[model samples]
Target: MNTEQQVETLQSALLARARALADETLARAKHEAERIGAEADTRLRVREESEQASAKQRAERVYRQKVQAAEIKMRAELDQLRWAHVQQVLDALQERLTTLVEDDAVYLPLLKALIARAAQAIEDGDLVAQVNARDYTRLQAHWSTLAAEWVPGKRIVLSPEGEDCSGGALVRNRDNTIRVDNRFEGRLERLADELQRIIVERLFATATPLAMRG
Candidate 1:
């Protein structure tokens, strides 16, 4: 063949080879882009799921805190109400005691019994009996006869000075070492804790049974 014809054929072959290389490179680039897009989509989905889980946990924590706070407030209010009720009962008991002291038919015997009890508790001592102003006068009038009947062996005498009490007697030895406080207020004070426990058990038994058990 002639030189011109041969050169044209070689140029055509080289041009076809260049076109084939361009097509292969374009296909590889498209495949790489598709792979990168899929990876990005997976990463985005994972991030969104993680964020949702964290938000749910935070919301749950806040809900628990609010519930606990409400429970604490409710318990505090109940405690205040229970204390107020207990105080009211105690005040009523004090008023009842005051009324009892005003009735002489009942109070006079109770006073005599209190003196006898105190005298018996002393166990062979020269005793001085102290009482409130009203009781001191009543006892001073017939102390000798009552003393002989109440405490036969012990030398018993009423004090010139009256005691500061509602009713009952305060008997002590001569030197003030041994004593028996049979006064109403003194006895009530000594039994205050037991009284409060009983009051709480009776009043709050149905309302807060678990709390009462504690």
Candidate 2:
């Protein structure tokens, strides 16, 4: 072991240390670069996810608005249709009802049937078969005949003290305790309520109107 040998050994040791340091630095740099790349990728993915969520939310909002608008339009149309139908029914009933009461030829059979039923419910004296004023005079003309089939002169056919009712008739015994209600308007009112319910069920409640779908 001399001075020269010692110097050479020191130089070799320094060189080895430098090489090791260089390798460590390179490895650290590679690790840092990979970490940075991973962070950037994560940021990009997160940003993309946020953008997709925002777009979906916007689409949902637009769709909901369209649905709402459509619903409002449909309701308006349905309301209009119902209003038209109601008007048509009212006008027809108001016009045709007068003609019905005026025609004894048309009403006699119905009156006879009603009178027969009244005959069963009341006692003989002062039993009044009352109807609208329009039909009263026509019905009174044949009292004996009407009563003959009724209670043998026990009752009278009379017109109620009013202009005219839409439909049906009422038979009243003296005490007014006994009465039969057969009114046209009254019957029509019941039918109208039923019709309203049916209409609602047939429209928005159903898949669609067959005629419209066709």
Candidate 3:
């Protein structure tokens, strides 16, 4: 072939080869871009799902904490109410004892029984008995006869000074080492815990729920 014709054919072959390379490069680049986009989409979806789960967990934790706080507050309020009722019962009991002291027919026999019990507790010892002002006078009038009848084989004497109490006797041994407190206020204080328990059981056994109360 002539030189011009051969050069044209060679040039055409080279041009076709360059076009094929460009097309292949463009296809590879497009495939790489598609892979990178798919990976990015997967990562975004996973991040969204993880964030949603974490947010849900945090919300649930907050809800649980709020519920626990509410329960604790409710229990505290119930306890306060229970104690208030207990105090009322205790006050009523004190008032009842005070009223009992005003009635002599009932109170005098009770007082004698208290003295006898105290003397029995301090058995075989010379005893001293003290009472409140009202009871001191009542007992002093017939102390000897009553004392002999109450505690037969024991030496007993009434104190000149009255005790600060609400109508019962405080009896002690001669040496003051042993004493029995058979007084109204003292007995009440000693039995306070048991009384409170009984009061709660009897008065609040069928108590309504605080939320349902009017």
Measured by TM-score, the strongest candidate is 3
Per-residue lDDT of candidate 1, residues 11-70 (tens digit): 888888888888888888898888888888888888888888888888877877877777
In model 3, what are the clashing residue pairs, if there are any?
Answer: none
Kindly list the per-residue Cα lDDT of model 2 for residues 1-214, writing each as its tens digit.
8999999999999999999999999999999999999999999899899888889888887887777777777778878886676666666766786677667777677767766666566665677666766566665677677677655656565655642565456677777788766566655675777766665565547445323210
Find the 10 residues in a row with the least total lDDT in model 1. Answer: 205-214
Q: Each candidate's TM vs. the true structure?
A: 0.74, 0.63, 0.80
Candidate 1 wrong stretches, greater than 4 Å: 1-47, 209-214
If ranked by TM-score, best first, what sequence of candidates would result? 3, 1, 2
Which lDDT tens digits does candidate 3 get at residues 37-119? 99999999999888998898888788878777777788799889888999998998888888998898888789889889999
Error of 1 at 87 (Å): 1.1
For model 1 the local lDDT of residue 203 reads 88
Model 1 residue pairs with clashes? none
